[model samples]
Structure formats: C-alpha cells, structure tokens
Target: MPYDTERFDGDILFGHNSLQVVYFYSIENIIRGWAQHFRHDASKKSFYHVDTAIFEKLWRWARRRHRNKRWQWVKKKYFPKGNGRSWSFSGEVEGKRVYLFRAGNVPIKRHIKIRAAANPFDPEWELYFEERLVYKVKETLDRQWQRWRLWKEQKGNCPVCQQKMNPETDWNIHHIVWRSKGGKNTMDNCVLLHANCHRQVHAKKMTVLKPCPV
Candidate 1:
C-alpha cells in the first residue's frame, strides 16, 4: 500500500497500537467508494479518466526515491498517454477483475491508555469509547482479600464440597447464578470456588458432593 503522510497528522502515527484514528476499508469497498465518488464504471478498467492525475501525483512522489532513467522507462511502458481507460491488468494477473479508486487517509486520537501505578497489583490498562468508561480488569488481585469476600458471600469453602481450597491457581471466581439463568456481573451474584467445583456447577453433577455451607 502507498503511504500518504500528507493526509494524516504529524503527531499521530498510523497502524496498530498507534494513537491514530483511521478508517480501515477493504480493497473491494475502496474500489466501490471511489467509483461512487467519481461516477465511473468501476468494473470496466484498472485505470479511468480520473486515474491519470492521481497516478501522475504518485509518479512524482515515487520519482524522488527511484532512479530517474528506470522510472521514466517503466512509466513510458505502463503509463502511456490517452490509454488510461483500458489500463486494468487484474484479470490477466489475478484471475479476476479488480476495481480501485483514488483515496486519502486522515488521523484520529488515541482512545486506549496503559500505565503503571503505585499498586502493582491493580490493573493498568484502560479503554474508552467516545470518552466514556467501558471496562477494566486487574491482572492480579490480593488472593486473601478476594477469598475473604467470597467467604462472606458464600459462607466459607467451596459451596459444592464445603472444603477450603488453595487460594491461588486452584480457585476461580464463579457466578453464583448461571449466566443464562439471568445472572448479572455483580459481586452479590459471584463467589470463589475450587476450579473443579466450578466445573461441577456447570455439569450439574454435584449431587455426590457435600452440600454448601448453610
């Protein structure tokens, strides 16, 4: 793809993870968009009446980086005068017809942020939609505190086994009510349990296990 730095901002860089806002379009949609804008039969050819000016601009930009003699030779061979309408070679090379149009890029502001905090345990990433809150997740949590909260909510141990679990990898934060059963993403509707217990909750095979703490 051709890079058009003139269309985007100097401060904002384009592509993934950059603080730039750009509308991404597929090549197909780009062709359609250009045809609509220029009022041309996009299916007819690789180059149209409007392509000469755009290609001329592109050639000027390209000549700065390429050898003048080679560039002129290539230009003369491919970009001849008065033959702009039948310039398409997509069918010969790609086994299909292709359409394209003159397009430009524009810059946008960053909506996501990642930062470090004094509490290394807290989540450091944030995402915004139109400057509004979306959601945030902590990469790690204080297991004792998390367990205490779950204990208070479920009254101790795995509700399926009434057995205490190792606080770290063995446990999982589980929804108290099935999500499909109208459970909400709130603390009151969630509890911590052994991973096995969580699976049993889903499998509905907890009958042989001890009942939850009363």
Candidate 2:
C-alpha cells in the first residue's frame, strides 16, 4: 500500500487501447525487490516463503541447529499459525517479523465525506481521491457513528436541563468526570448533553451530571 515510495515509477502497462491493463507487481516485485535492493544491509536482506508443512519441518531443523533459548523466543514471535492441510509461512528482516496475519481489513460504513479531484481529460466521468481514501472515509464514518450512539445512549435528553434534546445543534459528548481529574478518554466516561447545558455546567449555572456506569 506504500505506493508513494520513489522506488516505483508507476504501474507497468500492457496491451493496447481495447485490452489495456495495469500491472502492479506486488509480492514478486516488492518483496523480492526489498531483498535484492538491500542486500548490502544484512539486517534488511532476508525473505522466506513456504508451505505450512515445510515451515514446520524448517522450524524443527532450526530449533535443533540453534538449541538455544534465543531461537526458541524468536520462533514463538516469528512463526505463523498452521492448520493441518497447509501452512502460511513468515520471515524476519531487521528484527521485524513478517507474517501473513499482520495485516487485515476493518469494516467501513457506507457514505462518508471524501475529498477528490477529477481527471482533467475525463472531468465529467472520472474522479479520484489520493492514496488511502478508504481509510480516511472509515475514520470519518466511525466518528459520526460514535457521536450518534452517544446521543442515543443519553435517551435524547440533556442531563443538565433534564429535558428532551434536539440534534440540530444541541447534542454534544461531555465528559462525566472533569478532565483535570485524570479522567480517561472512554465511552463510559462520557455523556450526551445539549451544547447550552454543557456551557451551563461549565459556568456553574447547572450541576455536573453524575458519572453513570455505561
């Protein structure tokens, strides 16, 4: 995903107009490129790939070869979990463990604000958001969901005024425990209050809401 690295000069295009395709040589080009390109640096010049069964065999061989506790510790951290039929292998480079499960996808909500630019040549039909737009969109959606959930938990009432609240401009998440009192940033430590109620509580015009267990 680190596509901005200067090492790459854009995708290798193949075929002509009707059959044009972009080739992003990932595992083969990037992984091997790292190993070959950094050969002078022993700490960074390492790569490994093998079936689960082969990994187990190699692990046993390595264990017997080293016969020391350091190898045991390293094995525990670098080895990938294996299920009977086949194994997913892992390797290490510069003290970093490279494993298949190290990366994963998180659920993202639909419909979120994103900044984009349209292609000048295809302005009416093509648009693009620079790298990692999906991640940014997910983050925005998560914050919106958190705010809405907090509003729902408060039963749409302003804790200070003890009256029904309006969403247009009244809802805000207020910390139950004063931040100066070493309160943690957590859902249980917050409550939804009207913006006016928040100002009143801060100004001593309204009492602070009691810290309720969430």
TM-scores, all candidates, are 0.29, 0.33
Error of 1 at 67 (Å): 52
Off by over 4 Å in 2: 1-141, 210-214
Candidate 2 lDDT, tens digit per residue, 1-214?
A: 1222333222211211111112222322543444434333323112222122234444554455456668646465435454221333354545554443311111213344444554323312111221122234234555666567666777776767778877766355555654444555477776767666665665563445643536
Clash pairs, candidate 2, are 52-87
Pairs that clash in candidate 1: 21-108, 46-88
Error of 1 at 61 (Å): 46
lDDT of each: 0.40, 0.44
Model 2: per-residue Cα lDDT at residue 175: 58
